[model samples]
Target chain A: MKFKTDRDAKLGYWLILPTVVAISTLIFYPVFYNLWLSMQEVNMNPIQPNTFVGLAHFIDILTDLDFWISFRTSLIFTITTVIGTTVLGLAVALLLNRDFPGRSVIRGVILLPYVTPVISAVFGWKYLFNPVFGQANYFLVDILHLFPQHINWIESPAFAIYAVIIFNIWRNFPFAFLMILAELQSISASLYEAAEVDGASAWQKFKHITLPELKFVLGALVILRTIWNFYKFSEVYLLSASVNVLPVYIYEKAFASYDFGQAAAISAILFIFVLGFIMFYVKKVLEW
Target chain B: MVGKNTILKNIIFVVLLIILLTFVLLPFVTMLSSSFKPDNEQNTFPPQIMPENPTMEHYKGVLNPDIFPFLIYFKNSLLVAFLSAGIGIVISIFGSYSFARLEYTGRAAIQRGVLLVYMFGGVLLVIPLFQLITKLGLFDTRTSLIVTYVVQTLPVSLYMLGNYFRTVPESIEEAAIIDGCSRLEVIYRIVIPLSAPAIVSVFIYAFMIAWNEYLFASVFINSSQLRTLPLGLNQLFYTQHYVWGRMMAASILTAIPVIILFLSIERFITGGLTFGGVKE
Candidate 1:
């Protein structure tokens, strides 16, 4: 039996070997390699030549005001969008959690923003918000009489962030709604029935029962959503080319300027910053 | 008093649902409406909620060679998404089962290891992997995208399958073993048959990830022929600055497959997420 147990353990190690190799090769190695690059001076200009300057790239990115601006934009973008999405998602989930006519259809519709390609959705949104002949400006000016002509949604910093926020909220809420709705479903009818039997009001029951049941899921969602929203790039990049965010800034730094050194520096900054966020959430909220 | 409260609740619920629905539908509705508008009417001074002169010119423009072979990009995206998701499902089935039920010595440790990988966002690894993929001479090809995509998606799918596998009664596998079934036969004949729902859910989740993937696709693929829908649409927007109607048409065209898939698997998508979230 001891010999057989030892052999079984060997078989288990063999079975698990491929997964470890694949993850290490594909994931861990890249991260370590990027860490190496982040420490080097591999700027875009050919005349400058690549140099091994430890922490120089990091120092440069730290001092750059644009990087700080992009960082601020990312923070505002992430916090605002995640909060809005979660709150709206919860409200929608509560509204449609119960049976109604065409509930499934409504649920399906809610997922459209999430399911739709970010590029396509942004394009459509740009058309709608077109300042000149754009439908958004047209509606505001012609119908609502709120504006005179059109508003440049993408060019202006404020509207650019707002548009991106709207897009992000629209895209993500469906996911939150789905998760919360599932949690809502798991809440037994008996709890609500008992509350009603005790003459508890709807709000009172929600506060006592539903809210408590939802806490963990909601907490997890907020953490996960915040992490993802912090790193989100596609919608903002596709929607507003001029309005810079951290990821776009990274892209531009690397590809546009060919400043691989600075790009690596920014990438490292993003990773560390977001990792700090992950640690904070894990400690405080996820308790991982 | 209860009746009045119920009525008020219903009213508030209806109002909330309508507002959420509008938020959800506004982009799609706008896209659909704008797609039919004539080029001149597309970006008019006052946004026309309803197109006065609806034309199919934008759709025609999308089809023309001047803009791009939008259809080809569509096909490329669909192909990549479906193929990657299919490949992912197959890989995870074997890998996940091995992790879950293969009685490996370091199974718990390996599972934790994989979960840690999943928690680290893919963006962190992009630069180095870009170097690796480029060095391998696989850049700008669907094959490269499909292979690397597996790395990011496999962990989540494995986690989902692992959880599902745990729920599956071990007694059944024991019964199969007693019936003179080989390990492979037991997995195929028993496990696969029972885990179709979980498998479908994994497939859909993978499909969503592949379908919505943008960053790598944008970075790696350069050729027009190989470009996925996301990258192709990015080009369309950047290149054709003023072609609002046609851009909207292309947007609608691009979104179709994902929209369809989500609706079809709405139940599984919700269920899978809840199961994975709570159990994890």
Candidate 2:
């Protein structure tokens, strides 16, 4: 039944042709097309004359104070949040990795943050972090009596980023947990058995064997999460419209200011930053 | 043998589990309890984890036509999610099979290329995709979202299906071919049957991604009637501002289907995650 001639190769090409065409048309064309758009100034408003301004938008975006503020915010937000989620996720995964009481129910509950709609959580978080009547502050001031007056969680930029970070970590750690838990399960019981026979303590086995085995997954997840988190838009913006992150910054430029050119430029820059890691990840980590 | 260190280690694990479990459940408990309470009671001091007078009034409001186009939103979301899942799974099966099994020159190149396509962020394509859809007279059409969702969901589908297909022994396909099955027949009769679990897992995963998607649906589809649940819910939030009861009711309804499905298929989903993880 084997095709033993040149026709087989030809047939293979013919078979694959449609998929390649679809991929090119639906995927690659838009990517290359956006890259082109980023280069030229395309006025979103029909009234304004669309002009080609070379690299001006990128220059302007790079120099803009608001843009830099957001870039810094994104950096801090991405780093701290990712570290928080990964550490928390690993800890939980380790705890749940063993046979414990109520394990099945606890596992299901762990997925809540990942399962809940972003908008729902964002809204709930906003209400919880409300300066005046928010529940978190109420619990803090009224019950715990930690803070006397209200704390504006979403108003001040300093506190706003932290609130959003908390929300992000909460929503995302489950994803990390899922992956880490899967990895934890796969580690051979024999390795721990052998380690114990060799007089290795639990901490020593985890530190030497478990952590080392998890390195690639941890590296891959952190990279992927960082890229996703840095470009994370909806949660932060939805929580407070004023928080300036890269995605929101793009939204403002594209939608609010109606400056499609600048927005496209910023998008291109962010894509490059995000895509750099993606390419590395796909090439080295994912290894298709 | 029973040392202080062993006791200390056990205590640490207990403490960590307690904190983690609390973090996981508290917000949701708060949300669920608050949903049943009256509007004024949503922000009560000390935060009622258990409603004083638990009632279904908020649920009624959420289902009210004036509050939300609940039925319409539900129907639209169902249609969108089902359509995308169906379309995404079919296209990816073929595409991923070709990448996994069929041998030809440039196979590696194409695989890498598809993986690269996976990394391309949605934000970058938003403008052009909108323009293309508009030019195709699909602006504000469900078709626009459906077609665009394929682009978003395709990569993960391909990766999942491709990896699954690879794990399937080629000898089975060869034997099927020898039994006079055509290429198409071999796939339909053998491969598809063998990969049902993977296919189901991919469908559910892709559906969730499409189902929970908000930003694109919000941006691309403008008509309230055409809005998906996420968009519909957001619109409700915007208008009502802080009506916690109604919001939670809608949120709970929006989340119920997937949650129920996940709970039912918890074994399959976790199994898939484990499978995908090992390969990775």
What DockQ does every candidate get? 0.53, 0.45
Q: Which whole-number lDDT from 0 to 100 does residue A255 have in model 1?
A: 70
Over 4 Å off, model 1: A1-15, A43-50, A138-149, A193-201, A286-288, B1-9, B52-54, B60-67, B240-242, B272-280
Per-residue lDDT over A84-117 for candidate 1, one digit per residue giving the tens place of the 0 to 100 score? 9899889888877778789877777777787787
Model 1 TM-score on a 0 to 1 scale: 0.91
State every prediction's TM-score relative to the real structure: 0.91, 0.91
Displacement of the residue B86 alpha carbon in candidate 2, Å: 0.9
Candidate 2 clash pair list: none
Clashes of 1: 5
Superposed by TM-score, candidate 2 places the C-alpha of residue A5 at a distance from the truth, in angstroms, of 7.0
For candidate 1, write residues B1-280 as lDDT tens digits. Answer: 6798789988888787677677678778888988998866665554556889889888887877765678788788788888988877877787777777776456777788887774556566666677777767877889878877777787888888878887888888877877888666877998888998889877877877777778889878999899888887777666744477778888887777777766676676667352454211
* CAPRI category for model 1: medium
